[model samples]
Every structure is written in C-alpha cells, then in structure tokens.
Target chain A: MTEATHSAPAPSPSGFRLDRSSWAWVGVAPFLLFAVLFLIAPTFFLIIGAFQDADGHFTFRNISNLFQPSIIASYWISIQISAASAITGAIIGFFMAYAVVLGGLPRWLRPTLMTFSGVASNFAGLPLAFAFLATLGRTGLVTVFLVKWFDFNPYAHGFNLLSFWGLTITYLYFQIPLMVLILTPALDGLKKEWREASSILGASPWQYWRYVALPILWPSLLGTTLLLFANSFGAIATAYGLTGSSLNIVTILLYAQIRGDVLHDQNLGYALALGMILITGLSNGGYIWLRARSERWLR
Target chain B: MKTSKIGPWIAFTLGALYFIIPLIATFEFSLRLKRGEYSFEAYRIVLGDPRFQATFGYSTLLALATIVIGVLLVVPTAYWIQLRLPKLRPVVEFITLLPLVIPAIVLVFGYLKMYNSSSLLPLTSSPWSTNLLLTFGYVTLALPYMYRAVDTGLRAIDVRTLTEAAESLGAKWPTILFKVILPNVRSALLSGAFLTFAIVIGEFTMAALLDRPAFGPYLQLIGANRAYEPSALAIIAFFVTWACMGLIQVFGRGARGASPETR
Candidate 1:
C-alpha cells in the first residue's frame, strides 16, 4: 500500500503542511450515515420520549419520576452491585495478573489464561445464566450439596440467585477477565528494574511496592477500575438472564417499562432510560478521566 | 526466578477452580443422558434435531452476511474519518460508539417499533430485508471491531501517498479502496468479521424478539425443554464461538486491541 508514497512527512498543497492526505472521510461516509440513522436517531428517540407523555405531549414528568424513592432504591441497588463487583473484580484481577506475569506458573499458562479470558469474558448473557442455574438453581448441584450436608435449602437460607448478590457473582465471571485483560498491560508496564533497583537499595518487598510500584501503577489501576465499572454498569444481559424480568434492577426495569404493553407507559420507560444513560455515562466519564490521567503519567 | 509463594498459589488455584468448575460440570451433566447414564446420546440428540439444523444454518448465513456488509460499511467509514475527515473524528467516533451505550435489546425493540413495514417508508417483507435488519444489528455490534480493525490498518500505513499515487495514475476512488486499501486491511476486516460472527451466532434476544429462527432462539428452545442436550448444545456453541474467534485471530495476525466500527 505504501509502495508509491513518500516515506517522509511531506507538506500538502495548503500553506499549512499536513502530513498525509485527508481523504479518509470518504470511507467513513457509509458508516457515519448508518450511525446517524440507526444509533443516533434511536437514541434521540429514546431521550425525547423521556420528556414526553403517553399522549405525546412534552412534559417534565419523566425527569421528576427519576427522583422518586422506588427509583432511588433501584439506583442505590445498582450502584452497590456495580461498586462491589468492580472492587472485587479489580482486586482479584490484580492478584491474577501479578501471579500470571510474575509467579512460577508455566509459560504456556499465559495464552491459556488469555484464551479463557476471552471465552469467560464473552460467556455472559443466557448460557452463563443457565450455567449458574444448573449449579446453584433450586435443583442445582450446589443447592443439593447444601441440602445433603447441612440440611439447608437456598430459600430457607436466603441464598437468592434471583437477587443482587447472585447477579454480582455472575457478573464477576466477565468482570474479572475484563479487568485482567485491561490490567495485564499495566502489570507488564511495571518494569522489573524498578522492583530490582528498589530491592537492591535495601527496600523491603512491601515497601518497594507501596512507595514505588503503587505510585507507578496508580493511573492504569484507576483507569482500568473505572473501565471495569463502566463495563459492569452497562451490562444488562447478566442481570436479565439470571433473574428474568423479576428483579427491579435499573436495566431490567427499563427493559420492562419499554415493553410495557399493558401500562402503555412510554414516558416512564424514557425516564428509566435516562437512569441507565446517566449511570453508564458517569462511569464512562470516569474512564476517560483516568485514561487521560494515565496518558499524562506515561508521557 | 524466585520460588512461588504458597499463599497466592492457593488463592489462584481456588479462583481458577471456581471459574472452571461450572464449565466442567456443565460438560459432565451434558454427558449424562437417558436415565442419567454417561453417554454421547445428548450430543446425538442436539446435533440431530431438526430445529438445531435449521437454526444453525440461518445463524451461519446471518453471521456471514453481517460480516461482509459490516466490513464493507465500517472499513470505508473508518477510513473516511481517519483519512478524510480527521476534524470530525470525535463526532464520528461518538456516533459509532452508540451501540455500546444503547444495548441491542433496546435498539432492536426500537427498530421493531420504527422500521415496521406498514409505516413510513413503503417496503415489503422479505428474507432480504429481514436479513438486512439482522445484519444491521450485527453490524452495529461488529462496528466497533470493524472500525478498530480498519482504523489500525489505516494508522499502520500512509493513506495520502497511496491515494495520491493512485489518483496520479488516474485510478478512481473505488479502485484505490478495493485494490490498494482493502487488501492492505484484509486482516483487519476478517478479524472484525469473526467477532461479528461470534456475537451474532449466539445472539438470542434479537432473534427471540424478532421471532426469527436463528441459533440463539434454537438454543433457548432446547434449553427450556431438553436439559442434557441443551448442555451439549452449549458446549457446541462455545466451541463454535471459540473456533470462530480462533479463525479471526489466525487471519487477523495480531488484530486484537483494534476498534470495532459500529452503526
């Protein structure tokens, strides 16, 4: 492709010299059109519907509906679940990343971990829901084990697979892998020399990591954590698949409200959409902030 | 060089077990068939089922169509934004990323509402249009991968000189795109195509919602009724997804970390 082109950065016809030609936009035209029509338009429709009533009259009802207590409870529940999963995912990922990269595991384990990360990370939605069900559902192996050993049942013990805790556990399947994938690069970024130099200077292992390594890793760690938060926050499939339409989590609620054939509650559905958008948006914003911070640190 | 600490090793073993046990149990349970004896009967059941055969066919065709159209649409769009409209990259990129925020279930629901045949534009219902919508949905998914692939390919090579050189020789835009640019980014295209295929094959919500007989819906149907066979089907689906992704990785030759172009 570059056979005919000059290797050096050549000035353009304009007085202000741009390096390469600026005709790449031609290729982007078709996709851009698709984006506007499919994505942008639908999003606009969703957003606009929030401020409008079932009768199509524009109103502030949807915005006000967001601050209601039940709505508030759903938000709080989602926040807590997302928070717990993100923290656990980050912590476990940190250990796994450290061990896999630095531990005594065989060299072949790296690609296995990578490939498993792909399968496990993409292993959400329905099959994972059923996988958990087969293991922990009422007729599940774990439930049966619990019964035989301790005379326990999940319903009596309150180990609700149809609840927030179950959702979080299922979410971790993907979250941990995603965190590892994002953080492995950061883990690799921890130069061996930095650790060696610190250790050689008579610093203890804990002290070296605490003072030096932690400082270096802070940005990538933060950025990756925020990315994890966004990833988990935007996920609807896991929650939906695990509990069906029973749970009132934000995404599931939004899905139900939108599909409200009986109530015909268009405005309320939009309000729920707003909740999802804001939740995901905040995490995305945090991701961008940390990413920029990490770039600056790297530079 | 240092010997591994016992503590972290134990923790990882436990964690890895937690991750692996379900897959193993799922496999073991699937192998249990006909009075719960260990057998390949479940596999025979799932593979031999008529619905499975039909759904698998539709799913493959849907995935292939999406990949081809997705690559064609995304590569050009990514190429356009990266090479031609650099000033509007953010705007274009933002639009492309809408699929991530707007979940497929949500969008498909919206599409069902918006693009119904009897409304707005006059169009007839056909497998072609149904495939188009299905492809369109999958393309949005494949979009980010497609975008990233083409964008990376663009970044790896000098675009201006190639285009100018082609133009100087009186080569048209399409020729430059197909002959020079597309071939350069073929690996990227295939990688995106593979991802599109993987996601589309297992996608249940859209097919279920659209009432289209794709593989995802087939799995759902089997899952609700036949237990062991569904587990077998799950394994097959997993391997299919794995093989599809492996093919993409092989073809892409290090195409990971690239952006997917979305609609």
Candidate 2:
C-alpha cells in the first residue's frame, strides 16, 4: 500500500503520504457502513440463518424441506407467471417500440408512447390491481358489456379473472409498458445505415430483420425479457392486491410465511427468501451480462 | 408506404388499448358510488376518511425523510467516488443495484429477522424505531435510482476540476461540496428525489410488514373491504405516480440527466 508513497511526496498533511491514500478510503466509510448494515448484513443474515436450525445449529433441513410438493408448486406457478408475462410483454413491447421508431407514423407518437410507458410501468401495485379488476372482474365494464351486449359470458367460458391467466394478463399491465420503455432505446440504437446497406445488398425487409436487425437486437431483447422475469418474479404487491394471498405465487407464499410462518418451520422461511434472491439474482445477473455483450456490439 | 403505416398504427392502437382500457374501467368503477347515477361519492368518502388523511400524511412525511436521507447519502458518496475512487465505481454500482435484484419482500424479511426485538440492533423494538427501519429500507430501495441520478449529474459536471478549483481558492470540503458541487447537480437530485417520493408513496410490502400506517397499506385495506373507493383510491394513487413521473421528465430533460429506466 505504501508503494505509491514516493509518487505523492507533496502530501504532508499527516506527514505520511500513506495517510492521504487512506483518506480516500475513509471518505467512503459511511456509505459502506450504511450499505452493510441495512442491505448486505440483512441479506447475509438470512442466508446464514437459512442453514441453521431453530436452535442455531447448522443444518440443511430447510434446504431439503424446499422440495416439498406445496413449495415446489408455488415455485412452479411463480415461474410460469413470470415467463408468461415476460415473453408476452417483450413481444408486444418490442413491436410497439419498433412501430414507433421505424414504422411510418406521426413523429409525435413516439414521445407520447414513451412518456405514457414511463408512467404505466411505475403504475404497479395495489391500484394497478384495482384497475384490472375494474376492467375484467365479473361485473367489470368490459365483462358486463360483453355479457349484456354480446351474450358472451367469459366466466361461463371458464375464464376467471383471478386465475393464472388472469394474473398473467394483470402482470402484463405494467410489463408491456416496461418493455416499451426499455426497448425504445434499444430500437433507437438500430442504425438507418444498416437498413440502407441491407437494401443496397439486395436484401428483402424480411432478410434484413432476420440477418441484421434481429442479430443486433437479440441481446437487448433477451436481457430486457430476463429483467422483466425478475421484476415479476419478486413482485408481491400487484399479485397480492389483485388476488390477495389466494394466488399462491412464490412472493405471496413467502409473504404468508413471513407474516405467520405458514410453512411450519422458521428456518424454512429464510430458505424461501434465499430461493427468491437466488432466482432474481440469477436473472438480473444474466440481464447485466447480456446488456454488456450487446453494448459492446452497439459501441 | 401505406401498408407499412397500417401495421404500425395497428400495433400502436392495440398497445394503447391494452393500457388505456384498464384506466378507463377503473375511473368508471370509481364513479359507481351512486347506485343509479354517476357520482364522486367514493372520492368524497375516501378523502373524507380520517385514516386516509393520517396514512397519507404519514407516507408523505416518510417520503420526505427518505428523500433527504437518500440524497444526503447518495450525492456525497457518488461525488466522492467519481472524484477520488473511480476504481470502485463498478462495486458501488453493484451494491446499489442489489436492492433491485433482491426483492423488497426478501430485504424486509431479512430486516425482520436481523433487527427484530432480540437482535443486536433491535430496530423493531419500538414503533418509532421500526419507522426508522422502514425509512432505511426505503433508502435501500431508492439507492439505485438516487446513486445513478447523482452520479450522472456529477459526471455531467467536471468533478475533479471543480474540486481542484475549490481547493486552490481555499474552500473547505464542506463548502466545496455544498455550494459548488451540489448546486450544479440540483436538477439531477430533484429528479432522483421525485422518483424516490413516487416509490415510497405507493410502496406496500415493506411498510405493511413493518406495521406502519403508510398509504400503501391503507390503500390495500380499503381495496379489500370496499369497491368503488378502491377504484377512486387507485386513480388518486395513479395520479400521484403520474405527477411524480411528469416532474422527473421535466426536471430530467432540463437537467439532461441520465437515469436507467430498465434498472
């Protein structure tokens, strides 16, 4: 650490050049302390506690208990919802972004959509749940109108607004906008020169999208989809507000376990949170990796 | 060209419908407080309720506290890193981004365990301490936004040159930070502050678990029991979010700020 002392000979504050270097480290101490206490320590505590029995003895009992049928079902259902919403959001958001940026439309439309997308994406949680309920619930405007006007009963057709499909659709309320907000910039990165070059090379529009556009856009598209997956994976408020605890997604299940230890084991709750962190962490980590890869090409 | 226009319009229209219909439905439902006619009775009822005022007031204060703490913690740290510790940028960024990856529920769950009554710090030992804990949790949740915003703001201005100039003029560290650096990044800080306010207001899981009388829990409570009022509350919540987003847009655009929408 003192190797650089000769380079900073002008520093005489503490009569030791090494102390100047340490001042730089000291400047960040408060931030490090805050992060560790509130953020890192809490997470580390959970991970450590997950491996301990109720009496603080080290054990793998909680990890093994995670394989139970109910817990497995919760994880499965949560994954299903996340995948459904993310893929659906990505496809629609991509096309919407593409249309606004490349498709022949009013120039004002892109900014308008982008701004609305910003609001809509942030407009999640309880009120978002209510908005969907009002739109799709049994006596909701659309539902009632469909029943009264067209004699089409969605419920009789086995379409409930509180089921897996309903939750996925509800999740899309924010997911699609989030997709639009993210994909627009990525779409903007598509150079017009690339298209021109493709056309000059006798490539059809289909061929351009297939060989050039999709290749450049794939990393961003996949990364954003992964982000959306993590976004919904850990989302508890929207699902909780929409279906209450009845949805049985991992987040809500974890919420129940935290609230009352419904899992019948205190250690298992830590494991549940650990599993959640792992899933979201992996997806977000994947997103960052893919984003870095895409950014390299774009640059 | 005409055919291309058709496809784009169709996509835009479909996307708009998907977004707009629910809002329309929600507004219409909120007006259903009158049995035989449209009325703002639900709005009146919700606004008239004491619980609404109390929780909303509690959350607003909490949001303000979070913003002050978040800005104070993020700005100096971000500025310091930019000027003195560029090598640690990626590590700082990773730590800031941790909250996004680790769900709020998980973080709060950890908080419940690590700071509960019997823990070392025992943050949950009292209601006031729990509120402080929730404030810190909000700070954690807002860390990514706050740090990125201030860092970008700092980047926009020349941190090294400004600090060097201030030092040459015999300005102290506090004076340099407060008068020179902070004023330059005021817009970015406002942008971050607005976003943090928006997040803290509608936050549910953390506040609910922490047993605070925040707007999120109150909204959830009303949604569970009532019908039209929930819709009304939803619209109000939506408006608050919209207003915050709008403020960010105006301020962000003015500041020429860099904020990661996806993250």
Candidate 3:
C-alpha cells in the first residue's frame, strides 16, 4: 500500500509540490478542529477549572476539599466496586474464553459465545440494571423461585439487589462478556507448539500453565483487568439506574452534583471530575502499556 | 491423553446461565404486568405512551444525526490518514481513545462548564444548540468505534490505486470519495451506523445531563417511577441492541465474503 501510494502519479508539477503537500493538511483540519473544540477543549477546561477558585484565582482548595470524609468515602466505594467487578469479571471471562477457545468445546459454541459477548458487552447501562432487578429484586423471578423451591428467601438472608455486591454482580453482566470478547483472541494466540513442547518435557498441564502460559498471558490478563476497572469506574448509568442516589458511588455522587450542585461549590465539582479523569486515565494508561507488552508475545 | 470436557462444559454452562437468566426473568416479568394473566399490556401501554413515542422518536432522529455526522467526520479523516498522512495515525488513534479514558459524566460536566449560558460558546443557551451539543457529544463517544470500522474497511480496499484511477478519469476528490471509496465500504458504514444507533439510542448520561428528552432518559424516568413498565422497556431495549448487533454481524460477514482482497 505504501509503495503504491509513493509511486502514484503526482497531481501537481514540481514547482507546486510544496503547495500540494501543504494542502494535504487541509483534508484533516476539520477533524482536528472538532477534536480540539469538543473532545480536548472541554476536558481541558474542567482540568483547569479544578485548580481554580470561584473568583478565577488559582487555588488548591478544591483538591484539598476532595479529601473530606464523604468525598473520600465515595471515591473509596467506587474504587472497591470497580476493582471487585474487574477482578471477578476477568477471572470468569478468562475461564469462559478458555472454555470456548482451548477447552476442546464443540466448534459451533465459539461463534455463539462471540456473538453473545458482542451483544452483552454493548447491552449495558439502564436496561442492564432493569434486567438484574427483574431477576433478583424482592419479587423477582429468581428470588421467588429460590423461596418457593428451596424454602429460602434471599432478602431474609441479607441479599439486597441495590447494594454494593448487587451492583458488582449486575456489572459483571457486561464486564465478563467484555472480558471474554477481549481475552478470546489472546487465548487463541497461545501457540500449540508450546503445549506440545511442554508436555514432551514431562510437564503437567498445570505446570505448563504456571510456568509457560501464565508468563505470556499475565500482562494481557492484568491489562484487561485494568481496562475493565476504568470501564466500570467511569460508568454512571448502570449504577444510577440500579441504586439511584442510595449507592453513593463516585459516579452517582457526580451525577447528583451535576444535576443540583449538591456540592454547592462549582470548583469542587471540577475537582471531582479531575479526580475521575486521573483515576480512569491512570488505569487506561496502564492497560495500554501492558497491552503493548502482551502484544509483543501474542503477535 | 484425552482432556476431560467436564470443566469446560461446566464453565460454559455457568456462564450461559449467568447471562441468560436475567434476560429470561426480564421477559417473564415484562409479561406479568397484567393481573393474573400473561399479556403484552405493559408493552401496549409503553408503546402507546405519548411521551414514549416523542422520546423514542427524538432519540432515533438524534441517533441518525449522530451517524450522519460521525460518518462524515470519520470517513474522510480515515481515508485521508490512510492515503495521505500515515504519520498522523498514532495521534489520531490516541485522540479517539481519549473518550474511553474520560468518562461520559466528566465529558458532559466539562461541556456544561465550558459551554454554559455564561461561557463563550454558550451552547446550552437554547434547546436547538443544546441538541447540537448533545449530538456532538454522541459523535465524540462513537468516534473510536466508527473510526476503527471505517479504517479497517479502507484497509481492505486499494485506496491509492483507486484514487489514481479516478484521477486519471478526471473525477474530483469528492467524486472519488463518494462514488468510489464509499460504496466499497458500504457494509462497514452500515455496521458502524448500526452500532452508533445502538449506542446513542439508549444512552442515559449525556442526554440526561444535557437535558435532552432522549429514550434513555425516558427509560430511567420510567424505571424510577413505574415497576412493570421498566421491565417491559428493558426487554424492548435488549431487542433493539440485539437487532443492532445481529445486523452488524450480517453486514460484517457480507463484507468479509464480498471483499476479494480479504479472501
């Protein structure tokens, strides 16, 4: 493709070569302009606002304000949920991906799993919350089934669908599938020769995985876990739809803050957004770095 | 030694159950809206609600507008990057991936602060401008997916040769882009469009914060206020997402089969 483009007929004469080359930048100007105006500028404004006072004076008060108990508690809860969901999602999704790709399952199951994963990963936000509620809420089908058939009530046993654990389980609905979708290809990248070679060296299956496969796959595993963390960390819709404001996740807090200025300080809101950006940004950056490392082996 | 299938089967079964039960429960619950009988009464009420119609229609239009703007922005830029400015690939890709790093709530918060009624742009000053801002936000959210699909599509075709051939035939850039490149990537465009529709249709945060009467906000409102109706809406939303993914698969398969270069 590069050779073809390099050898293509030059539209401009040699005298106008510079002009034509400069004109090429015009083709991308609109895109760059749009990215700057909407994507970069808005976020940049918030990041800058986070460090400013209401009177437009530079101050660290907003950042310091985030250290208060309520704000810190919200961030802590958000981190816990994101980490819990991401870790569990990765484990279950890895098993599922392994089952379909390397578990010697029937051939038809792979496409079915892939297709379902594609749907479920995108099948997030509000409807996902409703689905889980209909499944596990007090009068839900599963709850009723467990009570009628097994003589047990989840509510009586301290299972609440609007709590932290409930939200994690609901999030796994999408997270696990996303894990499956992403990890399948990584699993497929496991060369058959390695397994055969390991076996010929008298290594057991577990030994092979622990010594050979795990080393190559850990970066991807960890990276995707981080990706999932960032994914749920930034998500508001599912949490909002499930627990409403009762959950006190950072996202819900931010949502309420945005809706009514519950924080009563505009700069504090910017600091809240800045904190979210920092967390998601760091996790995503780690994911990218680890993904790059894994790609070297997988490729 | 033959590996035992027990572990894989168990894993698959457990995974399948986890995914399927919620859907089954939602469907069953959606049906139980009426007293002592299974009926589509909830569906009827939801489908017949004037607010539902208005919001769904509004979101559909917004989704279409997002698709159009997204395609217009992404296709040319992707094509240009492939054909002219390959060096800018990394920069463009990084920008596209920024949306994933920055949450929608934060992005919308930024927009409110930057484009508020008192700000320079003041996009939130009017309903029309707010809708435009909302659409632009959707476009930003959909950028990573749309760009990837179109870029992959462009890669499947011989862009340089096609452009040269069109140039020799005295066709202008727009002619070559629309008449030549676009048709070759129709399936990709459709796949991206459907995915965008699925995303923008029931998107809750941006529209809710932007105060647009989108279907997502409507779903949340109904979920907050009503019981059985929310379940019904969940079923409907699932069906929409399923249909979108199914169509993407269909077109995606078609693209793979039809493109001689791929095979």
Candidate 4:
C-alpha cells in the first residue's frame, strides 16, 4: 500500500547498469515465468475448461453436473469435517497457548514446550497418520489392551480408524500445536502489565481475560484459527494416506479425480478443485486481512 | 493450600508432557524390533534402503537448489528495491507474496497443469523439471521471509549512505553491491537462506504434485507402506528442521553486515 505512495527517483547505475530498475522486473523474472506457466495459466485453463463443453464451447452443464446427488454427499461430508476440525483445533490451541504463556508456566519448560510445539505442529501430515495408526490400529498394543481388558470393539463400536471422525482426531496432532505456535506469539503482546493492571483494579482472572485480553486477542485468535481452518481444509496427505480416499474429504476426492476414477468427467473434477480453492482461498484471505490489521498491535 | 509457586511449574510440566508424548511414542515405535524386543532395526532398515539413499540425497540437493536460487534472486532484488527503488517496495512485496496468499497445493496444481508440456520456455521433464518448478515455488514462497529479513537488516543500517560513499569513491554498482551492501545485509541473506532451506526440505505437497521424491513425499510414501520407517523419517526430518532453525537463530544473533556462523 505504501509503495505506490512514494515518488520514484531518477535512475542511475554503475557496474552492469540496466536502463531502469524495471530491472527489478528482471530479478522477478524466474518467479514470474514459473507463476505464469505453472500456476496462473493452468488454473485459468481449469476454470475455462469447467465452463466449456467437450467441443470446447462455453456452457454450464459442467457446473450443473457439479451439484448432482452422487457428488452432494461429498460436499456435506467435507463441510462437516472442516467445521469440526477448525473448532477442535481452535479450542485446543487457545488452551495450550494460554497454559504456556498466560497460565504462567515455569521458565525452563516454556521454551521446551514452545520448541516441542513447533516440531509437533510441523509433525503431522503423512507421518502422523502412521504413528497414530501404530498406536491405535488393530493388532496394535493399545487396541489389544482395550480388546482384552475393556472388551472393546473398534468395528462394533464404530471406532474405526477409517471413519471421518478418525481423520479429524488425526488432524489434531498438528492442528493443536499449530494453533499454539501462532497464538503464543500473539499472546506475548498481551504483556504481564496489562493482566497486573486488571488484577490491581480488582478484576477476576476470568474478568481480566474476558475484558482486557480477549479484546486485544480477538483479531489474532480469529485470524490464527482461520489459518488453522484453512490448513486442514487443504490437507491431502494425511487423510489420503489414512483412509485411501474412502474418507470423502474434498481434498481426497480431488486427488481421486486427478489420479483416477472418483468422478465421471475430468472437467467436473476441475470444478470441484475450484471449489476447494475458492473456499480455502477465502479463508486464507480473511486470515491475512485480520493478521495485517492486527500487525501493529500484535507484532 | 499455599502451594502457589507450584502453579506455573505444574502448567509448564503438563504442556511439555503433552508436546513430548507423541514424540516419545514415535521413538518407541521406531525402536521396536518386535513387541518384546527393543532394537535399532528400524533405523537400520531406513538407512539401508536404496530409495532412502537416493531420495534423501535428492531432497538435500533440492533444498540446496532452492536456497541458492532464493539467495541469488532475493538478495539483489531486496537490496536494489529497498535502496535504489524504495517506491517499488509495496509492489515488489505484493508480487513476492502471491505464493503465500495462494496455497501451495493450489498453486503447484496450477503449475503442473500449465507447464506439463515442452512448449513453455525453461520447461523440462519430471523430477528435474519438477525440482526446478519447486525451486521457483520455494523462492516465491521464500520471498516474504527473505525480503523482510534483508529489508529489516537494510533499514537497521543506512543503505543510502553506504551506496553514496561507494559511488563517490568510484566503486561501481557491482563493487558496492558485492562489498558494501551485501556484506552489510549478509545476516539477512543468511537468515533467508536458512529459512528457505527449511521450507524446501519439509515441503511435501508441491514435490508430491510435481512427482519428485523429496523428503516430505518420501515420508508419505514410507508412512503408508511401512509401520516404523515413517517414525524414523519423521525424527530425521525433525532434527533437520531443528538444525536449520538453529542456524537461522545463529544468523539472527550476529551483527548486521557480518556472518552469523561461528568462526
């Protein structure tokens, strides 16, 4: 925003001087070429393809096919999962961050927790799925323990690893830590003095956080949760590996369409991909907007 | 009732315990040769696997490629824009950050569809082409981090005065660029390079889409097929990320215009 506000200076160059700092454009060349060829053009190609028929004339048939009953289940399942994951991740992240920073954790353990949280937040995806499986899957120790001692049955009880809820549980391994990492730094801006000021004024702990801290943190917490929401929205590897595309998540569905038989036509798949892009895109856009607005206050 | 000093201590312990539990489970998972016997067989299998040999090397090479490209392009552009063309900062910042706004999976999906053929300039075939695409993707991804690092460093020192002093003394753009400004912003470049390297190493979605066997995809592949190898790979990856992060910390600690690495 500020860049356009500045006045351009007269140009000069020593050693391999270019005619203009549009040469800065040259520095941008490789990224430009990559984005145009790889990212921009192909995506528009999908959009255009979605609007066009097999003969390549524009039509809404592809769009209409998007809402057919066979596919409608996918939308329902995906939205539910995204909502569940987002809420679960946000709550866990807020608590852990609160515990670490505000709940007054011991000094040595805070950094250790922070570092471990950093690693754990990055720890999910494909690797996490298998780790969780080893612990919880049939023939696994924990499963065997429950089966023998508690008379539990994953299949009978619908505690199956391949279930929708199963994937959400797997997602928390990272989502909680991710929420912790992003929200912790923002919480730092709350400062001890503000809490002390609230307490000195006779505010209860709940009141201090409710009035003083929450207001300051509302934008960041919302923004960070949105980011976590967006992250799980696009998550493909974990669910894809865990359930082998049986999970009916949007990403898994798209991967199936791209790789093989999940849909009738490829173009319909592109539209579905577009749906994922647009939804996740809007969430991310909102996150960045809130983050930018809170930057001066938070950073 | 008056054990108030234990309050923060208890919270930190619980948080730390929650964080380390999964990792400990992973360590146990990786160490189990069988139910009763503990062993390093998983690590042995991972190290001995030929795919691990090739893919791990490939991933390292890919990360280096990304860092080199990130440094080469971002350093000059960040400096030139920040110093000579401050007006272009916002535009440059916007262009650099397009990657951050667009999710990697979506953008890389776009790239794959766009550049799958030979007609495009600089287009190549699988793995190499994919790696090249990744290098560009990473640089773009890296731009926001790198530019901020260098920009902050440049702002910390007066780039205008340095450029003028060099220009008056007959130092050409290259000399001033090479000797004065770059050295001054070396910490930023180091920080940027370190951060870029970490992102590249851990990147899975792009590499998987482009069909390269980088570390992230390797983890996905191993995790799907084997029980324990994934744990080994994850630990290795965690260490690599930790080392890169540590390097960035070192780079961040040094004086601007000086090397951050210990002599």
Interface RMSD of each: 4.6, 4.2, 3.8, 5.4
- The residue-by-residue lDDT of candidate 2 on B1-263, one tens digit each, is 32358888899999899889888999999999889999999999999999999999999999999999898788878877887678888989999999999999999999999998987899999999999999999999999989988887887888889877876786666777789988988888888998899899989999999999999999899989998899999899999989998998887776654433212
For residues B66-98, what per-residue lDDT tens digits would candidate 1 score against the true structure?
887777776666665665567888876666666
**lDDT tens digits, residues A1-299, model 2?**
12122323443333433555665766676788899999999999999989999999999999999999999999999999999999999999988998899897889998899888888888999989899899999979999999999999999999988889999999998899988887887888888899889889998889999999999999999999999999999998999988988879999999998889898898999998899999999999999999998896665
Model 2 RMSD in angstroms: 3.5
lDDT of 3 by residue, A97-160 (tens): 9999999999999999999999999999999999998999998999999999999998998889
**Regions more than 4 Å wrong, model 3:** A1-17, B260-263
Best-fitting candidate, measured by TM-score?
A: 3
**Taking the tens digit of each residue's C-alpha lDDT, what string does model 4 give over A1-299?**
11211222322334334435544445445445544654467667777767877787878888898797767778778777776887888886777677667665556656666666655665656666766666566654566667899998675677877777887877877787778878888888887788788888998887987998888888888887788787787777777667876778777677666656467686787677677777777888888889887777764
lDDT of 2 at B106: 94
Ranking by lDDT: 3, 2, 1, 4
Worst 10 residues of 1 chain A by lDDT: A1-10
Is model 2 an incorrect, acceptable, medium or high docking prediction?
medium
Give lDDT: candidate 1, residue B161. 84
CAPRI level of candidate 1: acceptable
Stretches > 4 Å off in candidate 1: A1-27, A68-70, A142-156, A297-299, B1-4, B116-130, B164-170, B254-263
Q: Would you list the rank order by TM-score, best first?
A: 3, 2, 1, 4
Cα RMSD of all models vs. native, in order, equals 5.1, 3.5, 3.0, 4.8
Off by over 4 Å in 2: A1-18, B1-3, B257-263
User: How many backbone collisions does model 3 have?
Assistant: 0
